[model samples]
Target: MTVDQLPPAPAGSPPPARPGAGRTLIRGLGQLLITAGVVVLLFVVYEIWVTDLFGAQKQAAATEEVDEAWAAAAQTQAPQTDTVVVTDPAQLVTDPRERTPTYQTLTGQGFAKISIPAFGADYQFTIVEGTSDDDLYVGPGHYPESQMPGEQGNFAVAGHRVSKGSPFNDLGLLNSCDSVIIETQDDWFVYRVLPMPEEIPTWSSTAPTRPLCADVSVLPSPYEQTVGREITLPSDYAQILPVPGISDATVPADAQRLITLTTCHPQFSAAERMIVHGVLTKSYAKAPGFLPPEMGEA
Candidate 1:
């Protein structure tokens, strides 16, 4: 056939071309995936390495500030020598809101420093009043509903058990008779552990117990209402009044002036609480001349 006549042979349609479009699309997709993967990897590295490094530095700085506050507080004045006498059992009120209260700060011995040799928790923190939603963090604070540290009533203190700044992180490891000391402007109060149940129902009558009551009137709050109520007190009082636990008879009703330290039970969950009870044994007005060699300059 002649060259001019060959063109007329394919008048109706042309043959299908090869399928290169699929291959082109896949190559574009692969490039996009690689770019995305690189960006993700960079983000993880920043969080794992850079973010943590900065966070640790910030924590250290915060601790220093807490210590300084403690030191300043210690220099203020010694605790007043008010002889707290318990009187008028019927007149005593346990309702946290009813009592006239005094607030104090918890500081380290030399400075506002707190340390748990058992848990290796050594840092400077402050103690504030109230455990309302606004004030859980920072450090342990005295609950006004309870008695003061040296008072003849229960002195309860609460603190966070987890998180980096958790002042009570080692609270869980505290066994019976572990030492939990608090150093204030006046003196260092030492508490000895007493055997108690790990869990107590908040509403149970046997839940709250008075620890140190020289007289019925000296009670910080009403005994009938406060005993089993979900309140904090001195660890010493916990020995006399124990709530229902796996074992109840072991806890004595005569328990008085109890000191209670409460934190989360299973590390993170609020499902239960882990409590440590102690008895107030000795009060040292000044830093003891003979501290264990291990007790460093806090």
Candidate 2:
């Protein structure tokens, strides 16, 4: 057959393989994927570390600003009863549980300091008045509608568990009797961590769970123990009550002074919320001299 008419190359003639082009495309794609993966990794690091650094700086500044405000207010006028300084161990300030706390405008305002030795002596953070996202990123944010620290009712607060300084990252470390102290402008309010019973009782007397975390590690805690303690669902608003987990319980007026510390459960996911409930066992006024011995209970 004439060259022009040469039988169309065998039906199975393999097309010339574009090995160079294929390898080039594959190399380019591989690089692109690697670049994307690196970006993702960097973002995660930022969330876990850089954001923490920035949030911590903000928290420190907030604390200083709060102190300055108190100083300014003290100079302008006699300190209010709320801030009355008391040094007598015999005159321990009765927790203001019987009285209704008054907070007019505290959004973004640092009104108090929260210290949990269980989390670390340096675990203290400024507590602002709102629980909104804007409020929590700086540090722990108090439930606006809840009672103020040392107030008779519930003083509930929310915080990040794994990001933005992870203020409540060590929440699971709290055990019954662990001290959750709140240093307000006027007083040092101390609350003891109370056991939160599980919805379902454990088969054994000891709850199956991990021991209270001893440190403020940012990683997810491994609950090595088999405690029957049930993790509360984040949606349970009752968890924040002055008398938590009690729906029909008495209102704040007739209830014990309570404090609730809340954070997203499971470390990273917001699928659930971790709640720590405590009762005010002792309240002390801001004493200029040596602190009460009992106040130093370790």
Q: Candidate 1: worst 10 consecutive residues by lDDT? A: 212-221
Candidate lDDT scores, in order, read 0.47, 0.68
Which stretches of model 2 miss by more than 4 angstroms? Answer: 1-19, 77-88, 95-104, 196-230, 246-252, 289-298
- lDDT by residue for model 1 over 1-298, one digit each (tens)? 1211233445668754543776557667777788899899997676456644553454455456655654555456435365344443323223322222233433321122334444544543555555553344445655556666644546677677765356666665564444455555444555545533332232133323433221112123223333222323333234223331212323233444456667765766676666655655544443323232222322
* Model 2, span 1-298: residue lDDT tens: 1211233556779765544765677777877888999999999999989999988888888889888876675556465556445656668666454434332446887888888776655567899889887788778999877777887667899999888988888788766657788877556777776544442143133424433322111111121111212376877887665556655434544566678888887988879888777767677755555353433444
Candidate with top TM-score is: 2
Best by lDDT: 2
Residue 237, model 2: lDDT of: 85
Off by over 4 Å in 1: 1-114, 121-125, 196-255, 287-298
What does each candidate score in C-alpha RMSD?
14.9, 10.2
